[model samples]
Target: MNTRTVDARGLEPPEPFERAMEAIADLAPGGEFILLLDRMPQPLLRMLDRDGYRHDARFREDGAVEIRIGRP
Candidate 1:
């Protein structure tokens, strides 16, 4: 499967969310959207949940959050 990475680590609010939304819209079946964020994106997570997308979030050693989203 192909994985599209969106680096939102230094980005401000709304930008990260917008980028994530764009990635989700462009995601294909059996593919993944990897979002690198500076903090836990709670709002984004909620949106993903409401949109019927499955996702997982993990913290990196440097304190960045990595959110992986995919279709069920």
Candidate 2:
């Protein structure tokens, strides 16, 4: 599947979330929005869950959090 990535490691508050949300909004059908972060994003995960969006977040071998989001 095609993917759009937002590398948010070391970014300040809101910037990473902003970039991820933007990328998610612009994703093509059947594409994925991948967010790379230093830690898991609880707020984003909650929002996705509350909104019934399909999302998966896992820790990479390097200890980074990788979140994949698909359209609801």
Best by lDDT: 1
In angstroms, the error of model 2 at 2 is 2.3
How far out, in Å, is residue 46 in model 1?
1.0
Q: What C-alpha lDDT, on a 0 to 100 scale, does residue 48 get in candidate 2?
A: 81
Clashing pairs in 2: none
lDDT of 1 by residue, 1-72 (tens): 557789987887789888888888887776788899999988888988998888999999999999989976
For model 2, residues 3-69, the per-residue Cα lDDT tens digits are 7788999999989889888987787666777889998899999988986678999999999999989
The TM-score measured for candidate 1 stands at 0.89
Worst 10 residues of 2 by lDDT: 24-33
Backbone clash tally (model 2) = 0
- Give the range where candidate 1 is weakest over 10 consecutive residues by summed lDDT: 24-33
lDDT of each: 0.86, 0.85
Backbone clashes per model, in order?
0, 0
Off by over 4 Å in 1: none
